[model samples]
Target chain A: MRSKTRRAALAVLSAGTLLLAAACGGDDSSEADESTITWWHNSNNEPGKGYYEQVAKDFEADHPGVDVQVSAMAHEDMVDKLAAAFQSGDLPDVYMERGGGELADHVEAGLVRDLSDDAADEVEKIGGSVAGWQVDDKTYALPFSLGVVGFWYNKEQFEQAGITELPITMDDLYDVIDKLKAADLTPLSVGAGDKWPAAHYWYAAALRSCPEEVLTDAVGSLDFSDDCFERAGDVVEELIETEPFNAGFLSTPAQEGATSASGLLATGKVAMEMQGHWEPGVMQGLTDDGKGLGDKTGWFPFPEVDGGEGDPAAQLGGGDAWAVPEGSPDVAVDLVRYLLSDEVQTGFAENDMGLPTNPAATGAVSDPALAQLLEVRDAAPFVQLYFDTAFGESVGGAMNDEIALMFAGKASPDDVVSATQQAADEEK
Target chain B: MTRGGWRQRLEILLFVTPALALLGVFVVWPIASAVRMSFYRWKGFGPMEDFVGLRNYDRVLGDDVFRDAVAHNVVIVVASIVVQLPLGLAIAMLLNRKIRLRGLLRTIVFVPYVMAEVIAGVIWFQLLQPRYGVVDGIISAVGLTPPEQGFLGTPELALPTLFVVLTWKYLGLAVLLFLAGLQGVPDELYEAAQLDGAGWWQTQVRVALPLLGPTIRTWLFLSMIGSLQQFDMVWVLTGGGPANATTTMATYLINQGTQRHNYGIAGAASVVLFLVSFVMALAYQLLILRRDTVTQE
Candidate 1:
């Protein structure tokens, strides 16, 4: 019995030693020759994904000693992974960035490598593009694509409804919706199934009245208040009262809403949709002809409400960006230089992802709609980043929840104000 | 100098050490860290921690969303007791029968319990999606609109919808437990009752169900505990949305703790949840266990 005990103790000690050795082993990061740089991406779509993967491969080939291994994730999936990665302090060297100060969370946590000097140098080539990536005096992410949501109405349906032009004011738009409904058509296509899309109504309303500085501050502070939030609920209520949505929008899940929105708009069952430039891509997904709902389906900026600071030109939109994590071994300067090179920028434009950050990317893009969007980008005096990225997640929670409430009609515009105020108070 | 006595003590020490080590590593260590971290204000990322004691707790209670979340959890418990338990019991009784295709029916009934929460949520989400949903289409065909209003979209329906989802998701587990209890009941006792001129209902009430008291108690405890910890489905569906209607304790804790980067507040909420649930579980065990002992005596 004593002998058996000794043997058992010895066996346990041996296993412990093996585990300790393995755990204490060096990572061997100093190995000479080729370096592997991990790149995390969230691009899951076809050409958009293909365009990026090809660029990464091309970049790897150009730099013989650097292997850029790219991994893809879905949009929200990336946020969770990024959060876990940040907690573990093992962020990838490079990763996909959703624009605005979305990186602020990481930056505040000291997880990001500031590319201020690199951004300053690249700005000359990129031109007056300080919209998406800048934080204070520095840059942490670079602009990849530009997106703006407005009215994408079926021209045929509008014409059939005896409307000569798209509406340009709240009154005119609401009237148009009524007219469309009178014609037995769904007035507007809105997907509330993905609550975010449903929730956009509040942000759209808040953007109208919330001064740019205050809006930016509120976003930074995550100070949700009833004051700035009141208009969103009012606008949503007004919109809903017009019966602009399809017969069963509330019951529709987000995906089905996507399908229904596309189908109704394409088949001219709906006069218009509140969407961005990606409507064409969405349209293409739904139809074989790819001409979409009508040959004349065109976009108009969200019309101004009564007594609002935001003009037709003041837009709420954001895009993608790229950033290098602090742990990345590659020099930030070289990476930015290669990434923003005229050749790469040209490839980016050619893919029609969005208006390029590089000013030299002009004429590389040929899509008329995208080119029009670029014109909008240039003319805009203010470009709003998404609110989700503007505030840290907790305070941002207030905005998301309140916005959802306003959409569901449980809360009025006044309620949005109270909700935001409550959230702000709690945050403080 | 008894050699056997020393050997026996040595053997007991050896056996206990591995278990003690595992408990220390897996259970105690994490709990200790969570308790320690609860006193500090830090996003899960930053190295900086501002030591703030009960402040996180203060903030948690102050937040209306958190308050609403606690209320929602209470509602869920009430729902499980009122609806989930009874339904599960009925299903279990049916399964206990020597009916044809019993095995097939049991497998079919039990399948949903094993499904991953996210997968089940997705399937339900798909089934409920308004615009192009199959169920929506069927409802339309039947001249009955499912709702132009999104069931999950409206604030009124979000919590109720979540409750329905939870019921569907958890009923299978409840049924399984009740079935196990029903099997342990002595058939001879029922036969004796039958010989004594008792009906099936009387036999069940006077003998089977009475004997099943322990099993039922055990199951109710487990079901209630499980319901209180519910998070995944709520998070996936409304994200505690339509104005914080569906926010439960666990979901709120995570949002406050992980998403908002307020580990301190989340920890406070967790501590509260942990204490509340722990006490309930303990009280339940004590009551049932005492009753069980008395019955045995």
Candidate 2:
């Protein structure tokens, strides 16, 4: 009986081994095709996904014997999968690249193809926004979409609170918050739980207080020694004291469901949310009627700090770019160029995904508020990438954690600067 | 050796070899690689040329966030033993009685055990949201103000709230294990206790409880290990926030490894976490389970 039991166990174990081997072996067969240009994108939603699929199909039809495989997934999942692929040395030919410290790392490792000469025409089409995807003035990727972070507010809420003017300064912003509170409406809906939403406050504050040279130099030098960095923290500290955000905003998610910060603004439960240009679509998705705030939605650049050294025209933003991996066929570069073509970009703008970086697609933006945002973006003297993205993971994660501590009332302004410096020192 | 004896030994080896090989490949190899990688300053990509021995361990130990995570893990461990186990035992004992709807009560108690951990965390998150959640609604209906920051959002309340959810999700397993133990206790012992004029409480303390020692020990062991490695619920509900209030050791390791891309420090953390669990298991075996082995011998 005991031997019979052992025999059964042995049979089960062999079966499991065969299953594991089969699972591991299946992917290698699919990866052998050299003509297949694999693309990984984060546009996993309806219009974006379908549009990209159509683009790939058109590309395949135009170039016979070439297969374009498109894999669209959620943004976070794409990042994780890309990281895994990088480790395994099995990266896709063309993938979505958010240019910043992440792209810098990939460039240093020679994982990405230098598209400086190859896609120069597409880069020129993108104009100045292509600078974001460039390292040391040598382009490695092509920008597809770009926009700035701003306060997306409800016009009806502002009128209800009797606030007639858009806040252009810190004091005015505070006054608006007071009026909103007096009107019994939440002034803002920040999702500190995500950390990135809360970190934007510090980034904007630093941008307003620090000079352009200081901000740029700090990235290269990793030196946040300037008093302006601390002052930036102080600004955030002061803002926190106003208690302007909705109750439980610290725990609320950014844009997940009906009760998220964007949802609060969409449903008119809150007056404002500090978000990127994509907030409209996200807000629309959360509303019952699918209209979101509609015409009630308005945008304003982050208010300037009083007596700040920085230029008010300087903006903070980031955008998605397409990059070809090293060892990928020249066809991958063609795919990126095709993606940046005027026709594709115009279609992207019309879908309201984001502000297209291509100059020709500027007129395709249908939203009036988005068009105004584009004007503000164009007028800006300098555009700083989002700090967390610009600074890479190690330094950015630590800095965001400290900033979050301040938001939770656990750390001081000085502590934020020190923690950031310490983290940066470790990176060095 | 005789032919029959050799054949039997060969059969035993054939049965166990496949299992052993699989374990070595998956479990042992990764652990060994993790230990080796802990000494290097690697970003998980490219070559592992930078060998900064012991620095990763030093950094992980010195980090305040890691210290907080360790403390949170301890809190979970202590709570599991003090709160979860006793409550589970009490419920199991109640269900063990010959009462109406006993089977239904038992099945209902076991439901959460079968629910996926991530789903349970999300459900609890929805139920405890500050304004629209059921918990807050009930509180408002009773004329009491709910916490303004909400339970999972508040630093002071977040860990405890997570502990409550953990208990709710895991208590079912403990109850089922204890019920199985309760069923194994011979009926004659209870009869003898009653013949000795012992009441229900006395019978439980003198007979049923002592008889249930082995099951309790096994349950305790599982609970301790589960608490030490708690990740999914905390990750889903809080993501170790409102300022790292609910951060546990596993979450901290993941944040370092995956989020920060600091594979060396994360590997160091993995080693530290593994060492802790390994030592706990060894000590439990040597100090507690050894006594059971001795008694049996």
Which one wins on DockQ? 2
lDDT of 1 by residue, B113-214 (tens): 899998898788767666566767788898985755556656677788888988888888888888888899888998999999999778877887878788
Tell me the spans in candidate 2 whose CA falls farther than 4 Å from its real position. Answer: A1-34
Q: Global lDDT of each model?
A: 0.71, 0.89
Fnat values, one per model, are: 0.43, 0.59
Candidates, DockQ: 0.43, 0.53
- Please provide TM-scores, in order, for all candidate models, with all chains considered together: 0.87, 0.95
- Which CAPRI quality tier does the interface of model 2 achieve? medium
Candidate closest to the true structure, highest lDDT: 2
* RMSD of every prediction: 4.0, 2.5
- Clash tally for model 2: 0
Mark the 10 consecutive residues where model 1 chain A has the least summed lDDT: A25-34
Query: What's the alpha carbon RMSD for model 2?
Result: 2.5
Tell me what TM-score chain B of candidate 2 gets against the true chain B.
0.97
Clashing pairs in model 2? none
